[model samples]
Target chain A: MKPSDKAPSEKALVPFVSVDHMMQLIHHIGVEEMMSGIAGYIEDDFHRWELFDKTPRVASHSEVGVIELMPTSDGEMYGFKYVNGHPKNTKEGLQTVTAFGLLANVETGYPMLLSEMTMLTALRTAATSAMVAKHLAPKGADTMAMIGNGAQSEFQTLAMKAICGLKSVRLYDIDLAATEKCAANLAAQDIKVVICKTPEEAIEGAQILTTCTADKQNATILSDNMVGSGVHINAIGGDCPGKTELAAGILQRSDIFVEYPPQTRIEGEIQQLPEDYPVTELWQVITGTAAGRTSERQITLFDSVGFAIEDFSALRYVRDQLEATGLYHALDLLADPDDPRDLFGMLQRAAPGNA
Target chain B: MKPSDKAPSEKALVPFVSVDHMMQLIHHIGVEEMMSGIAGYIEDDFHRWELFDKTPRVASHSEVGVIELMPTSDGEMYGFKYVNGHPKNTKEGLQTVTAFGLLANVETGYPMLLSEMTMLTALRTAATSAMVAKHLAPKGADTMAMIGNGAQSEFQTLAMKAICGLKSVRLYDIDLAATEKCAANLAAQDIKVVICKTPEEAIEGAQILTTCTADKQNATILSDNMVGSGVHINAIGGDCPGKTELAAGILQRSDIFVEYPPQTRIEGEIQQLPEDYPVTELWQVITGTAAGRTSERQITLFDSVGFAIEDFSALRYVRDQLEATGLYHALDLLADPDDPRDLFGMLQRAAPGNA
Candidate 1:
């Protein structure tokens, strides 16, 4: 065959892990084990967080929803995730959030991986919470109170189980059907599951409280009275301005740890608190610069606002898995010409058959 | 098949236009005709420029190159382009720039289209220049002096011919091979092609002067003495900061026009000019609020640094063509659970056989 007719070179093909592949990979590694693996990567990245390029995500808000681009680089590698959140989408049988991401080599500015990030985002968010909880969760914490059990509910539960060695989870949601779905999905797992009718009942004897709901408004998923000292709280649902989960009373009572203060203050649970409220950076805790769980009776809240570096870590992990599993498709997403300057020549030579 | 075993739902699949498909689409419509079609879309969008949500692109700069995310939105649809530039990539047999983009519905915040944009960007950049020249070029202008015949050289020439009714092109490049490649690419076209040894030779009797060199520094491709009156200049190569093709003397002599003043002041040829240097916004001219070419002897310059709205227009045009031409593949890039909240249940159902 002539050079013109040859298949595209590897550089022109970005390794794309589709939804199906991501699912298969998760199953291949076991969901809990995969979450543990992802948490490990997040921990590695968080330890070296100073090396990352961080910026507040670029968001475009419309009447019903918001779309955002979260980008970051570590001198050698770069990544970005395109995600959208529309709380009303579920009513139309669509996901409330869907996402995709790209990872590229910073040296050549060429993409190395293109992967579906809806599933991956769910994984990474859960992993980040669990990884943070490892440092802050009370010693031998075995029970978790999972409120607002929606799409993210179960992942958060299993990630806690995998990374923190939790043996039981008590789930609660305002919607009974959502609670039932979470309970049924976990029935096959080794961990014990409890379905609680009220948020108060879910927190009974639980040391870890994970609240993940889907609402665009600031709804009180957990009030101050329900949270107690010596327990760790993972607040992930409050991830945008004007949308928060924990009551201001709970925030006042707890020592909050955050991903990036600039972002968390705007999007996380602390959006309810004063802008100048002091919160410790999670990376500092991981890097041994700040204290984590200094006292058993001290309430600790991981005010989680998903950051770009966690997604970058997830992309890096997925890219490393591609070669071993062969669970990816080579997407012809870039134009490659033999003579890089002659793009027009390449187009001319590849004129359509009908033309 | 079980519901879980069935193919992904429509909402889970995003339409992806690969490079091969883009080339096929371009060939089917003819390059000149395709660019004119794009120019038509651009004109329509430019007429309503005030409605767009615009922001300066977010760029990640490394030692060797830069990657950027350019995003914009109309009230109904939003779009963004991810592009990277690495000038040294040519030595590694890669294009200096490559890109891909997405368009989404503002109402749902779900992506509607994903397309390879290296080819599309080239087309849009050329079409934008020709579209601006059509409004600002001297009336009945026929010959264009094409300096720095690189990747974008052929498209610029043909777009001028197709949109502005140019009859001939005079090509010149510092590198002889580039000029030869451009000349050979145009040999199949109907327009007259002339190869010149130097920038001065290329401008002989040409009414339009187009400069598009790929360099990261300020270089005087066109001196003040080389440019005469009654001519239009399309200065596109001077895009990033510290990159300029025309000397300040030439800019001072011409009536500079730009896409967006805020960005153009930083990235366009006008970057060399004072911060408050007066320049006409090109969209205003299209909107009839600002004057374009009025006097024959008046020197006109289009300091073209690409804007996000142009990429949005290109994405819209490509998306509109997808249905009619059936030129895209539906990529399973989103996870859609039967119950939106049952993502974990979906994962359980799709557990790997090896497990």
Candidate 2:
């Protein structure tokens, strides 16, 4: 049957989530709550990882940075993220990374949501890190050393507080002002915050260590000696070719876990290692197919380069919340003609002659 | 530098062209004029095709349909289209293909334009076909046949009339109401329209023939006997594996042209031909690197499965027009924190105590 046979009101137009609306939702729901909610979704999706059709993100690299499209589907829903990375963008008064994404119905291939994912990415990335930490970090982990404090630092602190029960954060950045800002932001919450002069100082005695520096090269933010036994290392900054945060010895010493092995092999810190080096996929641990942190003294490393599945979970979570709160503004993103075949007729009717 | 370092008003947000606004623009400009303008942009871009970084679209296929992302860039600008094809969507009262795209600056990796391309795709596909016809069709060609009169039929007719000097069209479709509706929509224009009972009757004596049927399987809409010498065929509907329009015999007899040979070889009619079947890239002919129609009696076929460059050109054209007319709404698609490094602070400031 054609669209003409359907009722006028039955025509489908996809709902969109804009950046302003996302901010409103974050404000209304509280960022801490949003991060926790997304963490739940990430955990739920990760448990069913075998249901998804996953692939490495497609990237177009240039001298300045890289632009990527990360797409995934789980038979019922489809999602993708359009993201860019330009470390130099900060110098030009732009964010180092920006992103937007879409969620669509797998059955009909119609987009259900269009959302600004720059903020969502920060939330989701932190949530994913925390989710992994919950599985791999030692029990009663109370302190996290947040190295390379920047735009993402606060979200890391919030997600850790919500998901991993982190109560205190030690912050350090090459730029002291960034660390100061991170410490001040965390102080606004109920959590305890500390400012450290160096990475070694920040990581000392911390149960969890997160390196999220924004540099575009292979800069070692953490050495093997700085990390302690049983510490869960959430490596978030080393996401592109030639950009890594950990020393090779640290990776060799830890039980490394990754999102997708093929992608992480190319983009994660493992890019520095030989192809045959062993690593466990996080989903295996989440699904109880593999072990996570076999011993309290075992150093666990989550070499995350930010996978597409996290974005999928984040988009779906945000979309559901927006629908529940009725906080999203609908965009005329798809033409809803009275007769779908009469799209041209609608244009004609709206023309000057008809008007 | 922080955003506050510059005047607050000087920070510009990216303008968004919604599908509703794009439809309104088409109405204001007249569908005929809009098609002509987009055709001009496609032609201009095709002439400089070598300047573009082109790649075959990346597709994720499911049991029901396929979702795709097509990306291309010049050194200055980059663009990509997120589109899906599910012929079964129409049965569920949804469009078979829905798309949206982004245009970004290569220098800073900043997204400059994000617009809905569901309606825009019909416009660009028609424009691209007309552009190829302008360079490849015989001189003084006017009458044309459009098989498979669906949502795309009227746009193709308008583009042909405005770009290729077609004054009359013969429409044919498996669904009779589709042809009638298409003919009625074109009644206001100067072109004469006829509803033909069969594809053979539609193509008889026509200088140009366009087949745009939407079938997910290999179904021949045009036979070798129906095609005449000197006729320029715009075959658009057969764009994926297991989907085609012209019969293999007809393809063997015509001089075929494609957008990008590497891509079309797999997705276009050439999928039926030998590995080394002779075919010309439309850009070659547009740039005078190859000859188009050698004589009035030569049968030329443009296997036009819409390319990323055409969308890129149409996106830039629409963006410029939207800016000139001030018809687009600005979307805060990207977060603009006071300091780029203080994205988390934006949330902190929005907290209850701060607010």
Give Cα-based local distance difference scores for all models.
Answer: 0.91, 0.86
User: Candidate 1 residues A229-322, lDDT tens each?
Assistant: 8999999899998899888999998999999999988899998888999999988999999999999998999998899999999999999899
Predicted candidate 2 versus true structure: per-residue lDDT over A1-355, tens digit per residue: 2334222233345566765677778989888898999989999999989999899998888899888889999889999999999999888788889898999888777788888888899999999999899999998999999998889999999999998899999999999999888887777689999899888889878999999998899988998788778889999999999999999999999999999999999999999999999999999999999999999999999999999999999998988886578867666666656665666766565554443
Off by over 4 Å in 2: A1-12, A353-355, B1-12, B352-355
Task: Give the top-scoring candidate (DockQ).
Answer: 1
Over B1-355, each residue of candidate 2 has an lDDT whose tens digit, in order, gives 3334222222336677876678678877877788888888888898889989888898878877888999999878899998889888776666788788889988777788878897899999999988889899999999999999988998898888888889989999999999999988888788999999998899877999999988898888998788878989999999998889889998988999999988898899889899899999888998899999999899899998889999999998898797567768887677767778988877555444443
DockQ of each: 0.87, 0.60
lDDT of 1 by residue, B87-194 (tens): 899888999999999999888888999999999999999999999999999999999999988899999999999999999999999899999999999997999999
Candidate maximizing lDDT = 1
Q: How far off is residue A225 in model 2, in Å?
A: 2.7
Model 2: which residue pairs collide?
none
